[model samples]
Target: MNLSFFDQFASPSLMGIPLIIIAMMFPALLLIHQDNRWITNRLSTIQSWLLHMITKQLMIPLNKKGHKWSLILMSLMMLLLTINLLGLLPYTFTPTTQLSMNMALALPLWMATLLTGLRNQPSISLGHLLPEGTPTPLIPALILIETTSLLIRPLALGVRLTANLTAGHLLIQLISTATIALLPIMPTVSILTSLILLLLTMLEIAVAMIQAYVFVLLLSLYLQENI
Candidate 1:
């Protein structure tokens, strides 16, 4: 619950980010180093195959016209996604839980949406963003509402990740403290709490993946709708 400086530096960032960025890149580098050998073969190919499947499933749209741009987006998504899930391990820190980290990811997408929208349709970019059809008299009110909602994307993204990770970590901390306190006669509760924490850990993994995907999906859709 505490955003202490000691805890922040507990996971030292090479350049103000988690080491997981480097960790995640290892698999990608391995695939290249092996000359895509990981993709071939049969028995020892499941994990690589799954990674390929995920990359393909998510990278479909990105593979189109702006391939390089797509690569950038997918890379960020994959890297963040890996970090989110892997940080659930014992003695690990989830960077996404930090506001600075979350803002680092969200702000770029927000700016991209705005820039792309303007680039694609400069004629009435800002004006037309207020829904296509509305009562003429409510023009000012409608524009205000639409503008507020549009600007909220980054805020929503940051809050969603921070809230989820903080809540998950808090629950784990509470359970751990409870188990320690009950280690006397009610040893069974400690065991039960450990099991529950394990279950929640697994759920956290899924939530991590889902949150990354949702962020990327929403970003792509935002671009598509506006641009």
Candidate 2:
């Protein structure tokens, strides 16, 4: 009732201290490892298995040089996954919903892949701008289009991630708020809305997990192209 719908997206702060920093650190703190032994707990075992599966899948198309990125890619995946899922809780900010943060994440990584290609295979990299056997008249236009697309990759990445997460969060909030308001007036309809809200919550959970994977998967694909 207090904060406007959009205001909820604003970074939370207290006493002039920005708590978004703590929100960013929360996931890392939760991920800290405190146990090391031959016989690990079931939770640790499952965590290891999940990471192994993800790393193997991401590496399938990568060569030896690209394999060096598996660790960083996997860590990024885990961090995004943790923060996204955590943000689904009662009161927490989803940092990934912010365009600035997503862009910061996308730009440098995309640039790295682009630079890697230019450094290792300049001919092929620049050659991607123009395809072979193009009609003479269309050559200029095709090259311009391809170059624009290549430059737009990072913007697409950041916007895609931020938009999807923001839309899902907004939908959930709208539905939940309606359910609460309707409860006092119409109990039966409220119950129905609540059920829908439950299902949507489950779907948002899947979206959170999938979007994180997609973010990493796309980066790996970009890496694949470059390497």
Candidate 3:
């Protein structure tokens, strides 16, 4: 009875008011706890462990200059990871599914990385636009092309996250609809389809975790190069 499959991606609201504020606030669920004790709860322990492992991995390639970003990068990862997983639940709204939200997440950090590079190493950063030993004939073209590619990175990041989550959600909705529709006419087929849906849901969970990691990982790499 919905108007469209795309309706789920719409900014869920009540009585003409948008729920983006609530959606943004939902990541607080990942806070786990704020206890300050000798022994931590298991949930807090797991959260700390995950953050430590990810930070260690990302810091391996980065020098001390880039190490300052560990907390910021990890926070973004946890926020995206929590939101993506929460959205998989029935009747949940996913702000990350929107290009604007993803772009907002991507742009400032990307700009930070770019600005850091430009500020710390102007010659090297500008040098990236043109490789060494370029012939004079292609100098203009190469710089223009590389500059275009550089500017497009944030757009690519935003689109990639949005498209992956949106596609997965759409597929889940379509299959779920089919499963319900088949229940009355074809119970056996419906059961099989539901099994497939279960597997797909598991895959989506993995995808959610991965996309979050990749988003942060790429940013770390960006910061690594600049620092």
Candidate 4:
């Protein structure tokens, strides 16, 4: 069921920009509150333990740059997670399904990857961006294809997230709406659909976390590759 697109301005007062604004503040507040020697010492101890456990996969030392990257990614994940959970309420909406919101999250990472690659390895970054050992005859074709595919990554990521959230929300709405419509004739089917939606809602919560993790992990991998 394809519902009309929800406008950014045409939202409930409490569920509109205010909700997203507050959601975005969660990470900032956390970081701000932890800005101290005690929190720093505790975080250092935890990071050391984490590094010891993942010694084998350690591609680079967690320097200032790495720490900042991790902080930014974690903040994004937290913000998205909060917004998603908020949408599960009685009359709230998920801003993540909005193209503008998703792209706002995706484009910066894409730009960061491009800038990092160029900044770190200015001399050979372009050459390395294309695969090695391409036949001279097919070089142009390969470059064209690879460039297009590279550009599509962020687009695909944005669309994938938006589509999933929209689909799940629509499913819940349809089930509930149908249940109300057929309450007298087919209460059992409506009840079953509602149960399925409830289960789906639970699964979607997990999915929201998974999506955030995957996005951050991929961004890390992209950064690692450049360095």
Clashes of each: 0, 0, 0, 0
TM-score versus the correct structure, for each prediction: 0.77, 0.96, 0.95, 0.75
**1-227 in candidate 1: lDDT tens per residue?**
45542363245577677585555455354332234454555534765565567557655664254343566667677767777776777776777777777888888977887787688776566766566778899988988888888888888888888888777777777777677878786999888988887898788888888888887777776665555
Q: What does the lDDT come to for candidate 3?
A: 0.91
What CA root-mean-square deviation does each model show from the true structure? 4.1, 1.5, 1.4, 5.0
Give one digit per residue, the lDDT tens place, for model 4 in 1-227.
24343332233356344565554454445432334565467666774565444332333444445555765665566577667666666666677777778888898887887788788786565775478888899998898998787788788778877887777777667677777877788888878877877898898788776766566566666666565
**Between candidates 2 and 4, the lDDT winner:** 2
Count clashing pairs, candidate 4.
Answer: 0
Writing each residue's lDDT as its tens digit, candidate 2 over 59-95 gives 9999999999999899999988998999899878999
Off by over 4 Å in 4: 1-23, 26-65
The residue pairs in collision within model 4 are none
Q: Candidate 2, residue 85: CA error in Å?
A: 0.4
Give the 10-residue window scoring lowest on summed lDDT in candidate 1: 27-36
Q: Write the per-residue lDDT of candidate 3 for residues 9-100, one digit (tens) a residue.
A: 88988999999878888788658875768998888898888878988998899999898988899889888998999999998998999999
Residue pairs in collision within model 1: none
* Order by lDDT, highest first: 3, 2, 1, 4
Point to the candidate with the largest TM-score: 2
For model 1 the TM-score comes to 0.77
Q: What's the residue-level lDDT of 67 in candidate 2?
A: 98
Top candidate when judged by lDDT against the true structure: 3
